[model samples]
Target: MESQPILATGRLLLRPFTLADAPEVQRLAGDYAVSATTLLPYPYPDGLAEVWIASLREGAERGDAAAFAVTLARGGDLIGGVRLQIDAEHSRGELGFWIAQACWGRGYATEAVGAVIGYGFSALGLHRVHAIHFSRNPASGRVMEKCGMVHEGRLRQHVRKWGVYEDVDLWGIVSPIRAEIPHPLRSMPV
Candidate 1:
């Protein structure tokens, strides 16, 4: 659940995002570098962050998604958010995340994604969990890879941002008990 606070990783904490986190979320995620990687835009407004926080709360209760604010465990500083969308009927889920500019290159994304994926598999009993990111954000691709999701394919010109279309690389992980083996992406040649 989006509003439900979660335990932090050794390096990061995934917390429930309330209306209070709006300002910090906007400040961190509203930057050009941060927003460019995700679907959000630069110069985000005051109320936009509040809306997003509320959306997370609403989504979680409605079972549309489970999202968390990524924070530093020691200082409890907010940086970004990670999401998991559950498809209970199929026993699958989708993973997504965005970290602030200041936290870039610190492996915070990997820590957060790995924790969430573990929650997906162990807690949610999901048969499969997947993710995708813009090709422009190679670092996120690395996060997915490091989190054990294999790069399945690239969807060409699949998403339009600002005025142009962008490509996205799809990635996924699943239970080895199923018909296929769960390949930890660390072995991939990519």
Candidate 2:
């Protein structure tokens, strides 16, 4: 197990969430507009952010997950988050991210996602990484595409958001380390 390293992009810093960020995380993620499209609940229960941030430490210790607080590089304001729920047994990880509604369209999500994907491959030894977005949120899908992920498929009614079922679009990218070595999906016995 290793410490979660900070990931930086030109405009953003992807760092581990500190309890100090709990207030800003609550303010931004609590917004209905931000929670509507993602799984985060509206009203964003009090103290949950702190609890969640604390749990991330335990998860990281187990190699089960890595979560980063997305912030501005210049001003250092916390704006959002990006995380990987790692499946160590399969050598893969599931990515998830969100930016405050006010911060939408700034490319922060795309930048942070690219950095985390790199960390997953280079640091975590992941063979592949994947993400899922509610189909209605094409903007998020676009972010995934901008990061070089391929749209794998759509899972209809795969998730219930705010009580209504929604379709989820699946996207994935293989580690460049693995991509360089060409291989078949199957091996035939001759």
Candidate 3:
């Protein structure tokens, strides 16, 4: 991978998923707000979290496209997660992210995700990077904007969530390696 084994920011460290972080993964994934936007089952159990984390680690080893956890370098605690998954042909990858509600005010997701995108462009040698969010969640749209993705379009009633058909917000950032927008999204101070 062109991206180094790991990436770090002043307050964050983006590294591959590992089974050892299962407990923190449980705490964050188990949160309702995080799960609500993320499509993670609301009552995500500790065991499920363990399995999910284990699977992510395994997937990376198998050459599956995936992401690393966003953790505080100081405490080494999982504050969030960012994933970049490539489709089978390896042409493009999707960017996914989630931050614990408790960490929302801190701009952590923006920084971590941006760093990961840089990794993908430089190291992963990927071309297209995009993200989709349930329409009910506009914060995700903002995150995409913060990351430098242009407004592409909206898919009306594209998915079913909690038993009702729902819409989706689709935004994409393509690094031709020389796009006018030189950087990924960055959170603007509110």
Candidate 4:
């Protein structure tokens, strides 16, 4: 696979991250309020953004990831990011995203997520796309819900974040195309 295509929404542009974006990515994503709710590490270390940005292309080239810099469509200011970690063999992708704390409550997360899911199902031919959020952060779960994901389940003490175990809520949406394919077990005699 080559470079991921740029995605557009009414108020935002989902574009690939560049080396120049390292500073803003560091500034916005490094915030404690933003990092606390998501998987981003607190006291975000120096030069980590550059290293992370540099590493994204390898996954894109392998057709296994699509990491985007979320920006305002009008001014092109970097606001946050969204991604899909693809599992081609299983025809699915794990979705993740974050918005700068200043931009919260404006629906950017919901819009970007919807676009990425559309890309996953249509462009990537994924059968299912899912996301998970720390159970304490219902706002993130709300973003997933607004995108039409169902409350799949919860895992007790599923992830160790910042040295503490945190429960997580799983959410998912299967492609409409999935129903077109027959399940192998559907035809099995009970």
Give the candidate order by descending TM-score. Answer: 4, 2, 1, 3
Q: Which stretches of candidate 2 lie over 4 Å from their true place?
A: 180-189
- Model 2 scores a TM of 0.94
TM values, all candidates: 0.87, 0.94, 0.86, 0.95
Over 1-190, each residue of candidate 2 has an lDDT whose tens digit, in order, gives 7999989899998899999999998999899988888899889999999999999999999999999999999999998999999998989999989898888987889899999999999999999999999998899999999999999999999999878999999999999897776456556555
lDDT at 94, model 4: 98
- Tens-place lDDT per residue, model 3, 43-106, is 7775887788767766676655667889899998888899888763744778888998988968
Evaluate all candidate structures by whole-model CA lDDT and list the values in order.
Answer: 0.84, 0.92, 0.79, 0.93
Supply the TM-score for candidate 4.
0.95
Off by over 4 Å in 3: 1-4, 88-90, 178-190
**How displaced is residue 108 in candidate 2, in Å?**
1.0
Between candidates 1 and 4, name the one with more favorable lDDT: 4
Candidate 4: list runs displaced more than 4 Å: 184-190
- The residue-by-residue lDDT of candidate 4 on 122-171, one tens digit each, is 88899999999999999999999999899999999999988899999999
Model 2 scores what on Cα lDDT?
A: 0.92
Q: Which residue pairs collide, candidate 1? A: none
lDDT string for model 1 (1-190, tens) is 3346585798888977889888888888888988787888778987998887777777778776788889898888998888898898888889878988877889998999899888777766689999889988888889999988899999999999888999999999886545364558957888
